[model samples]
Target chain A: MDTATVKKIAKYLHLAELEKREVPRITLQYPELSVEEAYEIQEHLVQIKLEHGHNIVGPKMGLTSQAKMKQMGVDEPIYGYVFDHMVKSGQEISLSDYIHPKVEAEIAFILGKDLEGTNVTIHQVLDATEYITPALEIIDSRYENFNFTLPDVIADNASSSGVLFGTLLQPPHKLELDLIGVTLLINGHTRDLGAGAAVLGHPAKSVAMLANMLGRRGLKLKAGQVILTGGITGAIQFEAKDTVSAKFAGIGSVDFVVKE
Target chain B: MHDLISEKAARFSAHLEQAELMGQGVEPLTSLDPQITIKEAYEVQLATIQKKLDTGRRVVGKKIGLTSIAMQKLLGVDQPDYGHLLDDMVVGNGETISFSRLLQPKVEGEIAFVLKRDLIGPNVSALDVILATDFVLPALEIVDSRVKDWQIKLQDTIADNASSGLFVLGGKPVKPTDIDLTQIGMVLYRNGEIMNTGVGAAALGNPAACVAWLANKLFEFGIILRAGEVILSGALSAAVNAEPGDHFSARLAHLGEVSVHFNPV
Candidate 1:
């Protein structure tokens, strides 16, 4: 697609999310869209949000797990801009603000030093990450009926609507990056389970992928940005009054409530 | 109702196994239909595998698809899906495959596992897979899409038997103890030109881990990995398009090289 079309679709998607409504997938019109084209649309959406006074808080990695990646035939992780309004912690989310909302438990990484350049290794990511905490990603897909392609998801900011992180923080050296486990509970019932290895083999890898992926476009993850590795356990649908808590084995628990 | 989904799923399964084209690639089945849940997608997959079993096709092993990050992006699939590799899907190395039999064919390199004992698990670990006592061989998976233009969703591909076409296995077998599977590297050459390069880390950190994942995933359907199976543990890199007269070769560090040729349809 062209720049004009990309910007138009991005703006339309941004507005659709704000309006708390659904729209037809863009792939219906651009079936031949490339990954680069989709990423361009996403970057443009971030720029539009920035211009509208939404700060670029950080990036969120989606489709990082090999199981999920292989499940979709996509080869790599895709990143979307996380705006200031999207970040939250132990706060209630009104269902009116989203469409078809789902939730996944995950790990959050806060960068201590700027990570720049391509081919950033896991070790570099570990050294750069200051703290690791439990997190929950509230995904409200903007596409109708939760039906979308990778391109459609990318254009919609990886379906990210809200984020919640626990207050407990552990230094990188004090914990096993790949060994952290989480249990997602809905209304006191265990809904899912996952390990840090679920995110592209390790949570640190997500950070490294974020840096390298951004570095390709002459961008870098600055110090003190929060990046949520893709969902660890599978995503589950949540309605009003549903309470969700992700109990991270070594870290702590992050919880939130769905409200009308 | 569940009956409606099962009906459509059974129809799609028969069409795939019989090499029948359900429709052209213009509209994806997932996009066209709405009743199919992600859970039903797996049901469709199992239904397809059961159909193969009824047709006298022995299950040789399993295959894990979309192992590499670069591969998932290339195929536009976001997660891993799997398929059963019957005794028939295995082609010997240097074999000249007739192109007319395949639909929208492509090729990629992989590691093949030959097992020694039956393994079943809901919580199988990578160590369990390693201790199963098996030899590893180099392979080239010939992937074809029945869905036109390969416009597939995760469910669509799963229901389509993980987009399985065929795989060629070669090279001397090396015991699992001989090398660190994660560090094993490979270079795929198409028509004697380098096409892609990757390592075993692409397959969920190690190819054996793919088996562990497959076993654990299959447990959900009450299936088991029997002894004496040959599994293709997913591609090492992005797949290269295949054409008539194309020669594809993959060389692995410790496993040697595997090659497959294409004949005119």
Candidate 2:
């Protein structure tokens, strides 16, 4: 696709999102474009948001799990865009604005320094992190006629939608590093549980990996920035009137009720 | 290029029809043209979606598929794939979803993350993942394929973005450092029966690691993890077949529980 065409598509995407109206039967017109190229346009569209004064937050990595890779039959991970508008407090999510919004439990890190380069290490992440917190991510896709492949989704910004954050917890540098547990509940019923080791052997290791990757790109984990560790538990579905909550063994709990 | 894509889509669609007529389980779709690599197919698909955008439908979010090792093996690949998630694809958490539009839909449990700042790649780590994240939430991925019976292969899926169909997210957020993500447990219940069980560790030996891996990988493509972007780490358990009128629920030991009801076609 030409740059002009890509930008045109991006503009249309922004228009659709801004209007919150569904476009009718788009597949017939773009039957020849491939999924990767679609993302290139989508990326351009997201960049437009940044150009338009919406702050570009951070990035989200999709297909991080091997299981997901096996299921989808791909070899690499996909990525997406994030913006300031999507951030929400643990208690601030309004059920009305979202369609099929779901949440997952995670650990978040706050950076104290810039981190970039391709050869960074876990220790570097540890040194760069200023604090840690419990969090939940709200994901909602905007595809009207939902159906896509890995490439198709990557172009869509890894299905990034919204996020909810919990209170700040003890810094990673001061914790015992073990014995931390997580519990998830729905409608006041205990549904799932797990320990901290479920994330890449240790959650900190994920930081190390991220640092290394960032280093390669002439980027660094900047001070005051945040990173969301992968889920503490698998995803759970939600229904209207159902209250969802996640509680850490030492940290506090976060909850939201479904609406509409 | 148009002719190539049209031809491929048509051929794959026909094979799927044949497979159904024979009552065979849908197998992976292969590129009859050996010259067409998965990467190339992905480019074509991207072009297709872009063309649509030129006309109308806007971009919404991205979807991560094939997050499990089993899926990788089944699809004859070693990594996960992704797909586009449109705004229209999203439904209320409790809303009933009709299976009529899906070729073969399945559900999986995952942990999703929201970014707080820009995360460019090269050497992103688990700790860095925490520092850059805004919050986390519980999620249920509804995977469907346009291909018949969801039988497309890895390359085909790569082109299709991993057969991501719909997603439902619970409304709540938590930080990455506050929870012990690795220790979290997950139970998948279908029709009130225990269908599957998993731990956060199942995702690349740890869910946080999965995010770290993704951060580093994105660096190769000159992409970065942006703040406010919601990222699904991948499925903790196997993708269970979802039928209409069937109810599915996944409960995280420490996070929370989520459920969805599917309506018949």
- DockQ for each model: 0.02, 0.07
TM-score per prediction, in order, is: 0.51, 0.47
RMSD of 2: 23.9
lDDT of 2 at A241: 78
Tens-place lDDT per residue, model 1, A25-91, is 9999889887888889988888888889999778899988666677768988888877889887546
Q: Give one digit per residue, the lDDT tens place, for model 2 in A1-260.
A: 78887787677656656654434323445666776676677678788888888876665545544445567787554556567887875464566675455567767777878777776677787788788777776655545654455554555556567766777567787653323466677886656555544455456666666666555545556677667665556656677778888876556677876666
Indicate the docking level reached by candidate 2: incorrect
- Residue A55, candidate 1: C-alpha displacement in angstroms: 0.7
Lowest-scoring 10 consecutive residues by lDDT in candidate 2 chain A?
Answer: A19-28
Which residues of candidate 1, in runs, are more than 4 Å off? B1-265
Candidate 2 accuracy as TM-score: 0.47
What is the C-alpha lDDT profile of model 2 across B20-117, one tens digit per residue? 35544355556355465766656545555555565676555455566666667787777766555566667677678876555578889888877888
Cα lDDT tens digits for candidate 1, B39-99: 7777777777676677788878888987665557766766677887888887889999987
Q: What is the C-alpha lDDT of each candidate?
A: 0.80, 0.65
